[model samples]
Target: MSYAYPRSTGASSLPSYTSVPSSKTTSESWHDLPNVAKQWMVEGAAVFQTARSQDRHDIRRFASLIFRRTFTIPSALILLWLFTLWRGERTVFQESIDACAWENWEKWPQGATPHRVAFIADPQLVDPHTYPGRPWPLSTLTVDYTDQYLRRSFSSIQNALIPDSVLFLGDLFDGGREWATSTTTSPEERYQKYTDSFWKKEYGRFMKIFLDPWMDQNELPIDGRGRRLIASLPGNHDLGFGHGIQEPVRDRFQAYFGQSNRVDVIGNHTFVSLDTVSLSAMDQVDPQTGGTSSVVNEAYPDPIWKQTNDFLNKMTYHRGRAEMGELRMMQNRSEGIQFDYRIVEPADSAIYSNDQDEPVDLPTILLTHVPLFRKPATPCGPLRERYPPSSTTEELEEDEPNSLSISGGYQYQNVLTPKISTEVVTKSGPNVVQVYSGDDHDYCELIHREFNGSPREITVKSLSWAMGVRHPGFLMTSLWNPINPETGESLQQGSSPTIQNHLCILPDQLGIFIHYGCILGLSILVLLLRSSFHVFFASEPALSNQSPVLPLSERRGDSYKHQYQTSGTSSSTLAPNGLASRASITAFPRYPVTKASHDAYRNLDQDDLVTTTSKDKGGYRPARPRGFRQKSVLMGREFVHSVRVVALVVLTVYFFLIWRW
Candidate 1:
């Protein structure tokens, strides 16, 4: 039989093997674990006899993550900027004003997946009357130079936009003449020809300038799709105004592109190419009100508004407000009626984009030549009124199309103009997300904060110079779809388009400031993280175990006992040297778990193994390393802290120097 001590204290606190009586109970023998497990249990029991204290707080470990990523992030940015330089894109911060818009292509937030569409409007490519030796009008885009400018615009588009295809809102041609003359053919024919010669330029030339069907093999659009034919909508200039537009122009224009009112269903999204010119043309009013019939008055009474209304009426998504009223307009305007029609109401009918007479469940995009209306700020603010409405006065003498008054009538309606245009889109379907138009040379993005669902109108800037008031440029929209929300791109499906409107104007020289702000913000974040991690490691609980050393086994002599005193405290010790002088040994060894083996012979029952028995109670002590270990730990921590301070100072100086430069 064998006797064992009570399992009240930790393994490290148990008396030596010789102290236990040589006797064992059947229960203890039957339940004894494997030697491996006893060894593990011994280590586990030692933990209770150890002392530890925690002075650090960790709330999710975010501090360590931030510190580790600091170097990684800056290095990546530097590499990307270097790549941009290699591509001749210029370092993002070093771009000239003219190149800002073009350079924006590379600077867009990385990993954003946008349905990059090339949005260019109002080419208005027609003969602007200047022949050889004639001074170029500030408002004019002469026929000869228009082609050269168009080439330049398209070239820029190819390089900058990287669009899948181009969308052209019309007035593609000024349509005021056929051949540019250096006194060609009979010199007398020019002076004698009717001013109606403006209408004589063939659509063939229009196609070459915009659609570019005859583009040389080398001049083909980069995609080799050959100047991706434009999805077009004719402006008033394309077909003129009122009931008497020259049919030959309409016939020639339609021959190249599809219908003036058409829809292209693309990947569950609908692009409606609408001839608002023709729709506005039908804005016929009651003859009694004295308002003359506008564009295609009676003869070509386009039922665009009505057709669209019938479709929306069939959709189940109507929010039902007086908003439906703008979808269709039926008024009584007699002959020369001129009243304060605060809102330009929609025509009595408008075209709808549908597939086989069914309402589209997909998002719809309305493309038109005449914008819903010009933004009010356009002609009111210092920056906006930069150019007053180019052609506020009507021109009817030549009986030919006047690109000015026919296309841009900025102050034409209510405060939020395009009041009716909004209705056409809203009533079209609850899914209507965007409406794009281009009659105005300036750019406007009217986000409908009041609308319940999506409805944002984007008026694209003119591709070429418009009276030279504002710079000539176009819009670049970078929008994301569902799978791309994580990339940080703006998701237009539920939000406004992630857009950047680039132009020839660059008054902002603060790109560097923005970059610096981002860097400083990150550096401060890294410092905070470093501090947290430093504190966390410093405050880690130390696992301290106390066990009786063999030399302290069962008081051999009074002299040895006299040298050391038992203080009942594991931390209390008397030492004249740097080394610990306690009879009990304490060690902090990391633990690794192992499976137990069921063997009992290894159990100690011999008196030779007997060591000192200790009596200790529960308490917590802050463990301090002794001897040279204490000095080394203090020196290491201070060295690391100093390095951190030096690094922070270096970064501060480096950034300050860069900013000052």
Candidate 2:
């Protein structure tokens, strides 16, 4: 009879072969035909019986190993994914900033400082009203998920880029206008009720996502130059456009986010943020008659348009006053006069100052929600999605209806009219550097040669992923304005601050999910292959007649006896490598089971296979029970593995939860 050892142990434990004189050779035994086939089936059944006897221990060992790896590997991959991809915003944002490094055009002034401004456009925080057909739970989940994404992205920006100020170019909330209408139609009740209910909740959400993490309490942090932490304007979606504009909506927006029409002096340059939405409403035609309104002229009917008009008039008066003051100062200095005087302009100057022969020194960076007028066929750079107009006819339609709109709608307009565009650019003057606008939800850069000496107007892309664009992005601008020594303010006439803009695009979230899917598929494949290997190789050992089934003491010479004797313990107590032995009898050598082997062992009696023996009893003996130390060591190893698995699981959960909450 041949001995078969467990495959888990090495093949060196296999004993030397001992041939039986009457038995057929291992290669020739299979020629017995029917008799050999029957014997082979019997031997196969016996081998299965032997495996079944130890099946409980083997199953437990293999199952524990698989379970530990099942949790361990995936958990490790999840952590790696978060470290590299989920938090990869920092790396990408830094790379974008590096790409737009400032050039050494001239030496910077001592007082001049580089001010980095981060521009966030059209976040449009989602709500249930934004997507009516979606399930309520899904909508809520999306809102929470988007909030988390914004929070993480903002955190990355602060930690990595750390801009001096942030500018939000409108559309802060998706349902800002919706809330106004849904609360109440009456202008009187809408403001109070909207503030008390829906608006309050959304405002809280917005603050938590955008400001709370960085700012102190509710106060807007001001920098050394008196610039606030953030500057924002209202969008068509925020306060509505044209006839859709509600008085309460406008008032609430002003109360919360500050004046829609205002100017900021940063880095000695004028940033004129205008309420173009309300201003454009002046051109709104009566849908029924297609003409202007003429009712209630005494109080200047349609207060929405009147309010915007008043802001424009105030701006004109201020510009004229500033010009006259500068002119007076220059004349006084030239004449060696110390007295101060104020010059009063005639009433007609107020009406015609904007239409002057020489444009004012506005040197403005105009900010508006709606883009200025451009021909319907104007190319908005190669980055624009709808580019390279396929046909010349499609490119040159005067009333294409694809342009922001030829007219106005409920809450939006396509673009400002050519007349209004000329007015704004003319007032801003020939020194207008760049005009930035949003509400297009896509990146569009065009030159409006109609006014301001063809200033470049860039419509920033929306920052939210749900806004139709596949890739979301933000703009980073660096402004450097040198200060004059005589006056603490910026130089009146000199080289302007270098303004450089860089667009930083975020990764596609859907693509991240695809990567996760690949990881999962790979893990499952690994487990399947591992299980298959264990089944075919580890579980079944090879059965060969070349090795004899005998106890070491019975078959081996004095050399084997000397080794066991010198070990200071019996074969049961002492191990080859100082580990306690479990069995007193020698372990059997294993070989592949086949017909030849079966035929050889078929004639042997069951007593030929000696599993255990004791000298005192002089007969078969069962294996000894594991010692206390052995059991404790096994338990310790298992405990360590279990703890490792639990730790990985907890780490994976913690990373995912922290991002959401």
Q: State each model's C-alpha RMSD to the native.
A: 24.8, 18.3
Clashes of 1: 35
lDDT of 1 at 547: 30
Among these predictions, the greatest lDDT belongs to 2
**Model 1, C-alpha of 402: deviation from truth (Å):** 24
List TM-scores for all candidates, in order. 0.41, 0.61
**What is candidate 1's TM-score against the reference?**
0.41
* Candidate 2 residue-wise lDDT, 181-277, digit = tens: 3344434332344434677788888888888655632322222443345545888888887667777778887888888877665544567778888
Question: In model 1, where is the ten-residue run with the lowest total lDDT?
Answer: 592-601
In candidate 2, which residue ranges exceed 4 Å CA deviation? 1-112, 181-196, 213-224, 230-232, 287-290, 293-300, 319-362, 385-409, 483-498, 528-539, 542-657
After TM-score superposition, the amount by which residue 370's alpha carbon in candidate 1 deviates from its true location, in angstroms, is 1.9
Per-residue lDDT of candidate 1, residues 306-417 (tens digit): 4333434443332221112111111232222234544443542233222333332445666766656533333221122234333456522222221122333411211122
